[model samples]
Structures are given as C-alpha cells and as structure tokens.
Target: MDYLDLKYTPKEDIVCTFILKGKEDKKTLSSKIAGESSTGTWTKVLYSKKELNAKVFSINKDTIKIAYPLELFEKGNIPQLLSSVAGNIFGMRGIDKLILRDIDFPKKYVEAFKGPELGISEIRKKTGIKERPIVGTIFKPKLGMSPKQMAENAYLVFSAGLDFAKDDENLSNQDFCKFKERFNLITKVLDKVENERGRRPIYAINITAPYDEMVKRAEFAKENNGNCIMVDAITLGFSSLQSLLSKKWGMLIHCHRAMHGAITRSRDFGISMLVFAKLLRLTGVTELHTGTVVGKMEGSKEEVVEINNFLRKEWFNIKPIFPTASGGLHPVLMPELIKILGKDLMITSGGGIWGHEMGAASGAKAMLQAVDAGVKNIPINEYARTHKELESAIKSWKGFEKENYNYKIKH
Candidate 1:
C-alpha cells in the first residue's frame, strides 16, 4: 500500500491500459475515451453523476467491462486518480497507456506534487543560505587531477567557509584521478569538515564512468562515504541513471547534463527539458542542471524557472530535488538568479570562481557574499564594503551589474 513505490503514468494524450487484478476472477475491460466507442468493442457506463458524458467506470469478474468518456478524466486527473486508486490495490507493474485527443490538462492534479520535504526553507536550514541560491563550484573542466590534489582542494574549499564544491563530470580514472581514490580522499575531507563545521560541505564526487565501472563506483561510494554522487547523465543515458539511483544513499543525486542541450536547446527542438525533467525525477536524479539564465548557455529566465518548477514540484512523495544553475556563472548574478528561481536552487560558478583575484576559495566566499546580498536584497558592490571577498570581486568584473535576463539566441 506504499503509493511511493508505484507512480501512475498519465502521460499526455496517452490512454493508460492497466490489467485489472484481484477481487476479480479474471476481468477484461475495454477502452473508451469520453464515452464513445472510439474502438470496435466496449461496454459503456457513467461515473460520478456526470450525465453529459460517460466519464469513467470499472469492470467486474470476466463478464463485465465498462468504459467512460476520456473527458471525465481530463487534465491527466483521471490517470493520476486511476493510478492512485489502482496502486493502492493493484500496484503499477503492468499498466498499458492509451492516447487521448482534445484532452484537457488536469488543473486539480497540476500542482499535485506541490508539497516540499526540504523545500527552499529546509534547504536553507540545511546549508545556511537564507535568501539566494546556495553557492556551488565543480573542480572539473579537463578532469585530470590526482586524488590527493582533489582531496586537498576539497579541504581548502570547505575550510574557506564556502558552502559546497564537487568533482567535475569527467573526473574518473585515466592515468590520473581514479574514482575510488578520489572518493576516498574527498570523503575523508568531508569527515574533517563535519567535525569542525558541525555540518560538512557536501562533495558530489563524479560517479559517471563506463557502465560497469560507474555502477561499481556508485555501489562503493554508497557503501563507503561521500555526501552525494555526480553523474553526467546525458553520457550515461536515461535508463542508466535509473539503475544507479536504485541503490540507497544519504547524499543527493547531483546531475550535470554534459550533453543535454544538444537535444533540448534547439528552437523547433527535439524535446523539452520539461519532458526530460519529469523523466529524470522518475529515474531518481535528486539534483539536475538547468543551465544559468544569464550565463554562457543563453537559457531564458522563463525557461530556467519552468525547468526549476519541474524539478522541485512534488511528484508523489519523492523528496524535492534542487536545480543547479551553472554555465558561465559568478557570484554577482545571485540576486537575479534568486528572484527568478526562488530559493530551492544551487548556483555554481567555475572559471568565475577559479579565476577570482583572491583565489578559488575567496572566489567561493565572494559567491556566498553575493547570495547574502540577494537574500538581504542588497547591492553586491555595496555588500563589498563589509565582506572582503565580495568587495575584491566587485572591484574587478562586477558580475552583479549584468542584466539577469537570457540573451537572444543568435542561431
């Protein structure tokens, strides 16, 4: 009776065909989309007292099959309702999908997952960033650092008072940093932070590698230590992520879509990240990258918020996942980022942090300062008067001055 174990698929325009089970001695139900026998054979019936149309119905034993108009279950409400009811008894093991035309979206079921576990409030409580997106940076670009070096940087990143840092997507073994060695080293650094800071800065070590190697690493990391596991899912593929996320772990599933834009970014596009966002959650990615609005990738503010909503929206009882906004980001953009993304997000800067005049650690500190400015709704440069890191960074590029809107796509 654990509804979380089975989520119903009322995908757009598709008829969900579920093989009825139990109390029945062997039941056969025919299809009806909005009460008309769109197909060859079906026994029809009315549901709930709606007379204009035969909305929904049920079957009994092997002799009875009742079909209803698809409109009664409009807005995907019918499907979710069906799943909720069916899953409570039948489970989602074998349900077939049917397509619906002129289908209306279920407004009632729209914010179905509207609740939050560690929503913006809880994420803030956990990381201590009250207003702006939490600062995150990855120690990856080319991905050729030794485990010791990676661990060393992890220690410095935590020591500098920044919130979180992670291993780049491609940081697996290649005559350089092996996954085990790096995970082991960084995990040790996490323990150090835990003992000192009372709460350790999360380290999302890359678990993305060849299939066998990747699972091997994920299993190892889950069993051993680390705050979370990072995966370049586009490279690993959709199903692959599901496989890895199946294992238990305390850390969040940190995702870096190294090649996602190839399919999602086109105007007349292949598919929407919105679609992928739903699928990603089904597959269990707790944190996903939606690119930054004003950063290098050119995603619009609307696009950014839309994707963020998809990630955080309560889908079943699943823990709310955080959206990571990166791409050519720096600390200065935090205010605009927060205004659009709300608070359940993680903002990461790379060269913007690594190349800071004060140093990588200070750059991170500056990013945190930028977030504080956003939460407090103060000017970044003005915040600089007090926070040294913010002041130094503002003296240079002044990342806070840029427009927070998406740039027009040139192509």
Candidate 2:
C-alpha cells in the first residue's frame, strides 16, 4: 500500500503531475491517487506487485507527480491510458478537487501512436501559404444554413483571399444541411476558387458523428476532393480522434474542443488544456483550437502560450500540430493575436467576418488586411487608412481596446 518513492527516476514510465486538494493529508491523498490510478485498492489485496504500482516520486505543496509503469498502459490506446492515470481517482474518497496538470509519455509509448499525417509544414506547402498565420473563419449563423447557402458563403471568403473556412463545432448532419450535400457543394466552390486564385483553400468539413458514420463521411470527403476535415475532439472522444487519424486520409484534421470548458474551465478540478493538447498532438490532429488570449475565451496569455508551444514543439517522431487561436476573434484583434502566438498559428474568426458592416467578402478582406498589417509590423489604424475593408472593420467593431478585449460578442 506504500506508493511514495522519492528515489524513483521514471525512465520509461508515463509520469503524470496532478494538483490535488482533499480533507486528508498530502502524503495520504497522494498515495491514494497512486494506488487508485495504477494498482492496489482500498484494502490491500491478497496479492500485489511493487513494479506495477504508480509511485508518487515528487510532491510539492498541493501538487504531486505519479510515475506509472509502462506495462500498466496499452501501447497505442489513449482511452486505456486515460483510464489508468485520469480515471477512478477523481471520484475516490477524501478527495474534494483534482486537476490532471500534465503528462510525460515515454518515447516507446509516444511512437506507438500515429501522429499527424500532414503536419504544419506539409499543410503550409499544400495550401501554398508560406508565411503569415493561416487565416480562416467559422461559418456564421452556425446553424440553419442550407448546403447551397453554406457553399456560397464559403466561396465569398475563399475567393476574398482567406486561407480556409470550416463548419462551426456544432454543425453536423442536420436535416437542413446534410453532411454529404454540404461537402459536395463546398468542395465544388473550393475547386472553382482554386482554379481562379491558383491556390487551393482548405475547407474543414465537420464530420463528427458515430464512429461508422464519421468514417463514412470522411471517406466521402476524401473521394470528393475535400482537403480538410473537422471534428469536435472533446465531444467525439480521443479514441475516435485517434481512429480517424489512423486512417491517414491525407486530409488535414482540425480539432475543435467543443466541450472542453466543462472539464478544463475549473482551475481547481478536472483536466488542464495542456494535457488535452499533448494527447491531441499524440493522437495526430493537424490543427487544434488552443485559445485566443485577448479574445472572448477564458485562457490567459501564459497558459495559451504554453499549450501552443507544446503542440508545435518537437516530440520524438510525432508531427507538430498547428495551434488554432479562435473564439471571439476579429480583424482588430489580429495584430495582438499574431504578436502573442506568432506566425505558426491558425487565426479563426466567426462573427468577426460575418458581421462586417459591408458584407462577408469585405469582412474577409478586412481580416486578411489586418493579418497583413500585423505580419509587416504596421499599425492597424495606419494600414486601415489605405485599406477600406480594414478601415470599415475598425469602425464597425469600434477598434481593439486591450481593457475591453474580453467583452463578449454574439458568436
């Protein structure tokens, strides 16, 4: 039953760091966490193996680090890994709050899973956008748009020079906009735009449904010349995301964290977005919605930066995921977002593009102009003076104010 081991180095183990708060003392709660997550039970079993038990190697204040043996987790199974490290322990006795802060996977474990089929660089090459953050927009009026209307809207933005367009996380095979019809229409629009502009823009069609349905939709997209597919990663579950990635459809996988707030919003309990980002990267999502620091999202600058860094950094042979900064973002906020997140990002806006004073095309132009100004180190207002779209957007949105950044807009 004794799981504490200050001397353990954890060479080949899956090490997890957790912040736990409970009625029991730190040592007792930490041991309980180690025991419940790996081996050992409430009362000592008739048999036990010391090697299989997770060891609490480091404990600092309310934070504890538990190293689990590699054998305890299946090689490429994300669900099994979460079941061991992030399971049962949450509802255990004497625990009031628990947050899974981070996890360090051994090389052997990391290599077992298939990473991104097309990483950041490959995507850039395919999209023909060598520099500047990739610009995109979520289909506004997130619901109620028919397949033809959706395709027309996509054409407006793609022809206006945006790098990509996607379905909002909630949009799926609704009765009004069936998945196959939507995909067919949008791909045709993208093809037309590509022929005219000489650069194929990405269309991340949302294919989040049951496993078999999702696979069918993905195959449909692949056959119809779709370049990207979007999934509600959190809602669909990591196991489904991994399965989709393993298919190697040669389409970019865009991960939308739709229900992440339920699990990650609380600072005191549940899991951190950093952990989610790592698992998503390991599961091989080409792009993931991290957060927009100066936008309507809840994540701070430091936390978002850390999560984005982990997604893009080198992790054994796993391909780096493109960090997407979205939610309540717009033309005026582009400079600040680019400054904080750098060029290796996907700048996604919803109402920001659709709510423009002129129209969606003008709105799309404004977003691109703002990104151009930010990338060139030009002041947005000064740049807007020469660009009517940016000027209209600044006036329409009342410009970007750091003090009023978090004000919610109807997205």
Candidate 3:
C-alpha cells in the first residue's frame, strides 16, 4: 500500500515564523524550492538571527509546505519528497526548540485521516439515538470500592441502559482496587449486558501514567478486553501520545484535558483547546472532552460547540473524533447538551449516579431515558412514562425556577 502524501502544497495563505535559538543562516536557508510549477509563489526569508519565516497563500502545512503543487517533488513518495524539500544542509545542530508557529491548511490537506471509526452518524445509528445524545456515568472518588462492588455498580448502569461509562481520570493502581482486578470485574458485567441486553457501553479506563508506564496501561486495557482507553493526554505530552499511536494500538483514545485550561482558559493569550484538538487528532486520539454546555463547567455553549465542530469537520486525512461532554453532568441536562453539540457526542455524569435515590442502577436508567428524549426531541418530563426515575425527578424540579438555573440534577 502506498503511504499518504503530505508535502504541504498549501492552497491557502500560510505564514510560518520559527522562533529558535540556533544561528540563522540567511544566505543558505533563504533559497526557495519550486513546487509543481516553476510559475508559483514561493518566498522564504531568514531573519532575527534565530528565526526562519516563509509565506504562501493557500498552502498545505502537514509535513512541509510547497507554494506550488508538491507533486513536483518526486511524483509521489511523501516522506522522501518532504525530506528533499529541506535538502541536506547545516540542519540546526544545537537547536533547543522548533516551533511551527502557524500553518494555513489548504482544501486537500484539511482531511488526510478519516477522523473517527464510529463518527457522528455511525455512533448515533449504532446507539439507536437520533435527535438525542448518549448519556453516561463515571465511577468517581477514584478508589476504595472492592472489585465485586465495582462490578455490581457497572452491572447496575449496564442493565439500566446508559450509553457510555468511564473511570475517573485519577482512577489507577489504587491499593484497595487493583487495576486488573477492577478491569476483570467490570468486563464481566459489560459482557453480561451485551449478552442479555445487547447494550455495548464504552468503558473509558484512565491510563494517565508517566511516559513509560502509560504505554503499559494502554496495552493492559486492550489486553484485558476493554472497549477504549482514556488518558490525561495533556499530562502525558503530545509526543508521548504520538509514540503510542505509532504502535497502532488503535483503541478508542479518550483524551481528558485535565490541565489544558492553564493555557487555553485565557481568551487573549496562549493557544485554544481547538488547536490542541487538531494536533492530538494528528497523533490519532479517538474521543476528546468538550466540556458540558449545560453541566458544571466554565465554558459557554458556543465554546463547546466550537471544539466539537473542529473535531467533526472534514478536510484531509485527519479523521473526526468523538466529542465527549462531561463535568458535573446529569440526565436532566441531556436535551440541551444534544442541541448544542449534536448526537455525535459522549455524555458523562458522575456523582449524579451514586447520589440517586434508588442507587446507580436507577440513576443510569434516568440518564438513558433523558438520552431517548433528546434523540426523539421529546421533553424529559414527557419521557417519564417509559422512564419512571426520570419522570419522578423531572416532576419535582420541572416547576421549580432558578434565576440562574444552577439547580443540581441529583436527588
């Protein structure tokens, strides 16, 4: 099979400023290579003794950018063609950093990877949810549950019919709850759900270990029959995640932006989570947290949608990823969550399950009912006929009004 080409023959405006520490060789590095046409616009400049800058309107920025069609490189071989673009020169020996700054994506480069396996439509269809989004629950407080108890709770949610379930980001290697033990315990319940109820819920087990251990954890989940693996992608670093994908583990890579706000929270500075979303997608993660539009997070509805849009957009070989909305989520907020982000989403509620009046089983049922309501575009209150817990809860809170709408969805 031939490898995908990415020689950066950008079809749009692209200005790249590489802020570096090595000596800038203007005379040698300022030369521009011709693209498919000798008649195209390709300009290069070496400035500031440590910066390399280039400009191309509507250009591709994957591996290398070509002002003209990079098809001119070697007719095909992308890696070799790109390597030849830079040529063999001094090659910054002592460089401490290399920053891409910015790359304007052309129409073709916009999509290279086929984003998600079960993307927006497929996931919705598979889940049998149309207008409404899938609602999920996480096992929170990290640890202290015995393997049997964990399995029991998982069975509760599984039987209740919730769509997605996950372990908290920090739930790993607790003395009281061994990872393999818990994994084996939960898989039994999930397997039973599949055999009895035909419900295939996604279990996102957190694998937030340091670089070395992280790989082991990812392998562990796949080896233990896990549907997906969750990771604090921000905590593990971009390159770390890249190495994992290189091995083609290819399970659902759920990314938790645990520390992303430190850089993305400020509107006027740093980079947006949207940018990181693209980079992580490049390295091949499956599902990413988009925060809740209606749950207990700081981002507005528009922000969550913006991130989801980028994740689902089509451009090049980049495949779309699932947009997981979480953070203080509950069954009651399902309708609004789907409206803002669409059915190509993952909904996660935590304490909302354990705090329910009838325990995790009923809470999961309530969440599933709310999902049904969203997909069918029905009101949550109206869904109660099929979902008793949901109807009961909605009846109590339906008439109550909060000036700021800060009511918690738990009993």
Measured by TM-score, the strongest candidate is 2
Which candidate number maximizes lDDT?
A: 2
Models sorted by TM-score, best on top: 2, 3, 1
Ranking by lDDT: 2, 3, 1
RMSD of each: 11.5, 1.7, 9.1
Q: In model 3, how large is the Cα lDDT of residue 154?
A: 83
Write candidate 2's Cα lDDT for 120-149 as tens digits: 899888988888999999999989999999
Per-residue lDDT tens digits for candidate 1, residues 31-148, read 2222232322134343423333322333333222233333444332323433322223222223232211011223343334322223444556766666456677878445767889
For residues 1-411, write the lDDT of model 3, one tens digit per residue.
011123433344222222223343321222222221122233433332211223232222222232434333332122332243322311434333333333334444434433444456555655576655567778865577777777888888878777778888777877887878878888878888888877677777777777788788878888877877888877777557666666665467778888888756753233456656766666667778878766666676666787788888864766666788877666677777777788777778886666666677877877777777887889776677777888755654444322334755434
Give the poorly placed runs of model 1, Cα more than 4 Å off.
1-132, 399-411
Structural similarity to truth (TM-score) of each candidate: 0.69, 0.97, 0.71
Off by over 4 Å in 2: 399-411
For TM-score, candidate 1 versus 3, the one ahead is 3
Model 1 lDDT, residue 209, Cα: 76
